[model samples]
Target: MAEVAISDAQERSAESPALAGLAAAEAPRAPAFIVTIYGDVVEPRGGMLWMGTLIDCCARHGLNESLVRTAVSRLVGAGRLEGVRIGRRSYYRLSEAARSEFREAARLLFAPPPVPEDWLLCLSEGLRDIDLPLPWARLAANIALAPNRDDLMPVDGILMRAKQLDGHGDLAVLAADRWSLPEVAGAYGDFLASHGGLRDLLARNVTLSPEVALALRLRLVHDYRHAALSDPRLPRAAYPQDWPAEEARNLFVCAYVGLSKAAEAHVGAEFLSPEGHLAPHNGETERRLFQLRREAAG
Candidate 1:
């Protein structure tokens, strides 16, 4: 039998005013159930859970019925939690990819960069100006490991053709198809993790509408993907010398600083540390990302 030991500290934190406010009214236990479910199935061969089974599991953990249902629904909607329907009952399980994504997200949320603030900024600035001769061939390898999207490619072609008609040029079809959305998302996730503190700073100080924030994040992510793809170096290639690797590094840092400010302005300062650590946002971001993922799955 597997067991999860919820420490007294966890109990107290769950009951804390900060956490309580984040969790919706009438669902104090939802957050706890979310953590429990994630922890339970994070490992391999942990066994699948059905709706009924989850209900039972919640009971064991003293979670309320309503809260469990809400959490499960939200998780399912987010993509972190998946469901298989047979006849009447729906079986729930975490997708393998989701597990890896969540782990990466958690690491980003918790891990702190060791570089000094000034040095980090200097390196980032230097990378931007010097373009390294990246090995573009590595893009093939990245494409192979990433998810495929034939539907998007057709749309891409249509857009390209339309641009040609309008006398505007676009990349060749092959090049356009070289990158996958999941890989892009994954890369952005990695980028966010690496410079989370900086992002926290931005999220806190920036005053932007929700729509603008989303646009900024998407644009930055897109720029990163294209930059990686255009490099002659392989998809996994490190920053090349052709560009100022330091400048590029600084760009990433600045981006995170902006994202941090946005998160703080929209979410709350409690989710970040004075130095822009994401410890406070770890649980919330995990839950939000999980929910977003569940929605994607459906």
Candidate 2:
């Protein structure tokens, strides 16, 4: 059994008034917060959850039950979720399409894919008509460039592996031209400014209440998700020396793991799935905590 050993320091930190306000920083929009709850908690235990559980969780973030219901209705209409009526209770699960999308988001958060070492040079006559994904930038009428990721392959062009050899231009300059480094950097900087203190608080071995822990964890991931998804995951050589993406990632891992124990306790005791209260320590939850701990150690 995986166990969270709380220190006496954490017990004391819980009594501090300043530390208690960490989770009360600010509330995100209802739709986004609901998505965060499903992605972080519901998706792991099972893809489905009770409506009451969702409302109760969102309430911690100052989202009213009516707003949550409306947001959930909108999510269902948008094909992000599906609902079923079980007697008087209603349960919602991620739609198949949304599940696939959430899985990709989860990869970027929990287990980031490696940056592509090779570059792809795609040459095609019909480049304008073709839709190229994965941050491909059109360099010419018949050519485009992108980091060759394993998950993406463009069949519309003659793809060739490329290596830069003694080029006059700096890689960082090329990166800025091809991608919005300033925007991405700004997002990371914002994330650090907002949640950076949580890292220090956790380092002091602070133990938050289950409600606060879960609320803060949701907020943490909700904010980090915006930044992580925006990032194109370019090779380290392509990034500026002052890039704070890695630092933000490390802080996320530390604070997330620090809060996992109390957060899971909240889920176990309060959050409900179609099958009654969620088990606090399922394989998926344990695996996530274990993987994050390993990431924190590294």
Candidate 3:
């Protein structure tokens, strides 16, 4: 079975120090990694997966069956996943409550919204725990700022449109003050360093087996998701001169595209919904690959 081959591939990967080291360097928490697997692989093909299939996929990342079960229990408790039983087998799918969150995460991972050029300055005396459209940061107790976007419906608040004057102070300093830019940069840097070897190895025309390719692709998305989601994704003008986002994004595209063919082979063979095994290509999957390929080419 493909799952057995992944175990074999892990043993063989020891012969390649780069692959071995990369594998051992990171073991993402079981719950988050499960979410990544679902978002990237399960959601597009069909928003469901068999428990046995999920456990097999998680095993590639060194998660034990017990750990995955515990993680799934927690996700169900958190309303992120819901389970169904068919005969004696268990199947799970994204909960309706969590679909929006998963969709947002997918957008960030695949097709992130561009930062608007204009700005919105919101003032509210009673701003407590409110969900304004994302990428907004609280400047003060009663003031918040976000890029002015028209697509999102307006929230209940006093909104003002503002523009940067011709002569402006450094926006990067302001951005740094408002958000955790240093931490985000460090995450991106670590991702680049940790995965650059694999990227280079692929560049040399080295081929990977389907199992190995799937593992690497999963790891790639798992690591990049942390950095990308943490980012507020402000306008380019506000970014620090040395921002590594673009560089990280470029690497993500290259690595994802490079690993996708073989990885999809593994997915088609292994990833299953209650209906059946996932298709290798679908509208959602095709859209993702098409966009990433264009970006890689560009």
Candidate 4:
């Protein structure tokens, strides 16, 4: 990825001590609007959206038109949104790479070994105290705490049961249909920002044992597959039966590579196995997770 260039004004704003403190406090308060926009655009068959239409839609959610427009522009600048001009209006869509990144992000958020529900309960309480709208908070909490199934196939059954219990089956189906990568990413980012301990844990555990890492990776894959498959919009035709397995394997490899590279920055290559792998050590949480996954998979 190329480094982003910021203007002097932006640099100043970023450096201001007061603004920095405010940003730290506010970031968690805002859920992933950028990712949500991306998901809204991509979940549909067209995958392209008019900027004006998006602004109007966000307006219904109490977001200022200018704020929504600015957020879209920032996402475009970040390469997550590709701009296409038709006549006088501009349309934005996700690039292929952005889609892949969002897919990985979605997998991470809905994956197994879920985050604790109390984390979101605390966030919702904080938002309530500040008089913030509760829809986003409610939705985030639902996604995070949804029951995990053994595999992807059984997920649809759960969704169907949820519909039967509620009269708004169609609404539930519509909402599930709209779930997408960017939305998941935005929610995950928001959740992480709200929970300080989560951020600290991710930063500190850079050299997780391979066994533990694999377990975490598998859980994430399992949950992602289940979530996506349950959604009405994501049909089996879009993702074949074998796709989940393949994607899961690919994610594991990518995570392993990324973690190993990060570890190499501190521990010398000598600590790595002869085949450039990280072995499990006793007392590592990741190793325990790996064992749990083994039982789950079996």
- The positional error of residue 8 in candidate 3, measured at the CA in angstroms, is 11
Who is ahead in lDDT, 1 or 3?
A: 3
lDDT of 4: 0.39
Error of 1 at 234 (Å): 30
| Off by more than 4 A, model 1 | 1-32, 105-119, 122-298
Error of 1 at 140 (Å): 37
The better-scoring model by TM-score among 1 and 2 is: 2
All candidates' lDDT scores? Answer: 0.39, 0.83, 0.82, 0.39
Q: Per-residue CA lDDT of candidate 2, range 251-291, in tens? A: 89988988888888998999887788888878987888888
| Tens-digit per-residue lDDT, 1-298, candidate 4 | 1333445455454334322333354321012454554432232223566666555544433456778777777777777778877777777777777777655544443233332222111222333233222112124322311222222222111132111233533533333333443454444343333322322334444444332333233333333343333332222232223333334333433443334333323222122222232222223323433544553364
Which is better, 1 or 4, measured by TM-score?
Answer: 4
How displaced is residue 40 in candidate 1, in Å? 3.5
Cα misplacement distance, residue 115 of candidate 4 (Å): 11
Deviation from native of the Cα of residue 91 in model 3, angstroms: 1.1
Candidate 1 lDDT, 1-298, residue by residue in tens:
1233455454454334322222322322564345434432222223244566456434433466787888878877777677777767676666666677545433332231222211000112223334322111122211211112121111111111111232444323333344333444455444444334434435455344432333244334333433333322212122222333234445553563344334333323221212232232455445544543443343
Please give each candidate's TM-score: 0.28, 0.90, 0.89, 0.29
Q: What ordering of candidates by lDDT runs from best to worst?
A: 2, 3, 4, 1
